[model samples]
Target: MNDGTTTLPWLVIREDDNGNRYRVGRFATRAEAQRTADSLGDHEHQQLYCVERLGARKPGPEQNGTAR
Candidate 1:
């Protein structure tokens, strides 16, 4: 949290010939939300964010919705 004296950490994006990357906003409570939002990756980031992983399913139909 900011105490009216310290600067807040912001989310920023880095772009390269490969693609864009997004960094999530920081822990400061008083920070401006817009500043972080602006740093998020744009459309060019889509391909960069792709990953290979297994899909998990959650229980349903009266069962707890925990992942299986």
Candidate 2:
């Protein structure tokens, strides 16, 4: 099913020890993502990963239509 539509770009994602994932940044190339991740450095229970955004959002707890 190729509609010839453009998709989202690549992104640098970070994951913490608690199994939580977040989008750090977005880049036009994988190399850029890799460099950013490398420059970030590694920490205990923390890691950076490269993944495509694909027009999707990062997973997290849903809002209950109320503010904290």
Candidate 3:
């Protein structure tokens, strides 16, 4: 069974000089995510911004139509 809900697979991540990472945002498309990362990276040289795709996840109860 498929739920109507969709997940944003593209992630915009930020890594600081200390090597700590933070999730900036999620997007439906890679282009949107990358564009945001590039703009943010241009402003902050010390922090690295990049786009990554989330790994596939198994459908949970909600997605399986088990939960209300």
Candidate 4:
């Protein structure tokens, strides 16, 4: 059964000057993720930090729907 509950969807992303992107962390709230991004950004001026909301996850084959 689909419980309608999702994992942490807020993402803190770090992008380097060379355009390499990395996932810093995931949070349940945007504020929490942003705070972490801000802290990291403050210490690393050469890197860009940002927060993004992940799209709702689709159900997999193990669940009720077919996997994409």
Candidate 5:
């Protein structure tokens, strides 16, 4: 368990019809992520993006944690 050569996976970012964004899955390749995104049901607001580990946890505008 001492191997530090392992690379983290890329994440698929999904946005729902309500404009809610979240991480859908982690993939080893962009092609795989694109496949998964394309497989999702048709939705006007739904969109997918491929990002690295550090960007996977990016929150939506509503999740900014600022009090209104």
Candidate 6:
């Protein structure tokens, strides 16, 4: 969003099922990010995944877990 130049930090969460896929949220704020994670509880079907995916095509490396 906003030309991939966010003023606040962002977070991405996704859930995979078989060959199918489900994305939780791409939050502009840290609180929203945590909220998305909390919604996806410890369920087998609900495969929770977090990534510090910077909103940029030339993004640095994606951190393959929840943000610190």
TM-score of each: 0.21, 0.54, 0.72, 0.69, 0.48, 0.42
Residue-by-residue lDDT tens digits, candidate 5, 1-68: 14855443656566555667687777767566656666653445435443434455665655322111
lDDT of 6 by residue, 1-68 (tens): 56978564555555465534345567677667765665565445556456454564423335344422
Q: What is the C-alpha RMSD of each candidate to the true structure, in Å?
A: 12.1, 10.3, 12.1, 11.4, 8.3, 5.7
lDDT of 2 at 11: 71
* lDDT for each residue of candidate 3 in 5-31, tens digit (9 for 90 to 100): 777988877767787978889999888
Candidate with more favorable, higher TM-score: 1 or 3: 3
Full ranking by TM-score: 3, 4, 2, 5, 6, 1
Please list the residue runs of candidate 4 whose C-alpha ends up more than 4 Å from where it truly belongs after superposition: 1-6, 56-68
Of the candidates numbered 2 and 3, which has the greater lDDT value? 3
For residues 13-54, write the lDDT of model 1, one tens digit per residue.
233456554443443432343333433433444322111111
- Candidate 3 — which residues are off by over 4 angstroms? 56-68
TM-score of model 2 vs. true structure: 0.54
Candidate 5 TM-score, C-alpha based? 0.48
Candidate 2 runs further than 4 Å off: 1-8, 42-45, 51-68
> How displaced is residue 33 in candidate 6, in Å?
0.6
RMSD of 5: 8.3
Best by TM-score: 3
Model 6: worst 10 consecutive residues (lDDT sum): 59-68
Q: 1 or 2, which is superior by lDDT?
A: 2
Choose 1 or 2, whichever is better by TM-score.
2
Rate residue 3 of model 6 by lDDT.
Answer: 93
